[model samples]
Target: MHSRSRDLVEHAVTKVPAVTLGFWIIKIACTTLGETGGDWVTMSLNLGYLIGSLIFLAAFLVLVSAQIRARKFQSTLYWATIVATTTLGTTLADFCDRSLGVGYPGGVAIVFALLVASLAIWYRVEGTVSVESVVSARVEWFYWVTILFSQTLGTALGDWVAGEDRGGLGLGYETSAAIFGAGLVIIGLLWLWPRVSRTALFWSAFVLTRPLGATLGDFFDKPIAQGGLEFSRFYASGILVAFIAGCLLLIPQRAARRAARD
Candidate 1:
């Protein structure tokens, strides 16, 4: 029975989305929520970045632990954990940048290093750094670690690019988002060019989307002169969370269906 259960688990593992358009959409939404929601707690609610990071980090630990224990890939749980990680990443990045006085560039540099290191370690441990191998707990840990680092890095990079001449780039938030969006378009063309490595293209787009969403979130939450909609971060976050949950529920994705299609 144990052997049979293990086989079932492995079968289910091979049946996830392979980073399609819908996948990117939901991922961007989650990242945007991460940005605004984290800011709502840390800045609007006046919780302080350190305390906010601790709180979100605790939530991430709990959700990821549950994800590890599940017998099958429960979509809701998996995506919920993703959302949790993004939120935690936002707070952690803010803690490093604002609270610790590292500034955006410094935070981006440190987190970029961490993201690269996480990928190196993942490749070393897993032999292949494919998202398809996320069945095992070890690879899953590596995946989430990489994700956390990327999300945090995205926040820092977005801030760095969007601010005034204070940062190196000096692009406004909307302009930064446009530039990143254009980059993603180039990546999409490369991915479809039939010459580029699919694996490389996939990871590149995944990382780029995080920062794209980060800049969009900033545009939604920042002041008018700064080129933002000036929406309440709390309201924006709530709307994004609802949208994500609704999409997950209505997406008609099933492991069995995905397995058959693959």
Candidate 2:
């Protein structure tokens, strides 16, 4: 029993990349791909939002299950799961906002509430929301659930701030991207300041990056009349995927060190 327990613990070590510059770069790229890829299936392919959501949700489930079953961090698997969540998030948000007639503000509120609830439940159950503590299956589940919610929330936020229709802010894609990018800069500065929680900052920045990527993706793929570059969603998704592949090959990634437990 003792030997088995030790082995289990050892195998449960962090199965995610160490938080680093490379991680952020690839994360942004993946989120951008999520937006463009989701659009390709739903709009370009004429599948519609509901179908797109179902397809991406299936991918998210499969990838997340694989992630949970893995014994150690596989960069490819981790990133594939992330991309799945983002793609699912994009279509899911669209369904909620447009299909359900909730509008962007309502969709944002719902997803944001879900995200907050997930974090609260995670902290209540695990006593911490730090990614460093994701050394067990239960904690890993919490982490991924929170990520999915946050990703969905980001899509709603991006649409609320940038969508030309649906009573959005009228900022257009590029300006919205710039604003979210500036928010990330502020978060970075806060990270350097003392008396601030690094974990909180990390999650905050993580959430912000999604919307930034979403807006940038829209800027690239939406029509010129819609204040976008009018590029093909398929081509945009392919380029972003190539960029992500290059980053994964060239940049270093390793599972984060396990945090000491009390």
**Which number leads on TM-score?**
2
Q: Rate the local accuracy (lDDT) of all candidates.
A: 0.79, 0.90
- lDDT value for candidate 1? 0.79
Query: What is candidate 1's lDDT per residue for 14-122, written digit by digit as tens?
Result: 3235566777888899989988988898899999888889989898999888988888768788778878888888888778777778778888888999998998999
Candidate 2 error regions (>4 Å): 1-12
lDDT of 2 by residue, 1-262 (tens): 9999876674555988889888999999999999999999999999999999999889988988889899989999999999999999999999999999989999999999999999999999988898888877899899998999989998899999998677688888888999999999999899889889878998898899999999989989888888889999999999999999899999988998766442
TM-score of each: 0.89, 0.94
Q: What are the runs in model 1 whose C-alpha is more than 4 Å off?
A: 1-16, 165-168, 255-262
TM-score of model 2 vs. true structure: 0.94
Name every residue pair that clashes in candidate 1.
none
RMSD of each: 3.6, 2.7
**Residue clash pairs of candidate 2:** none
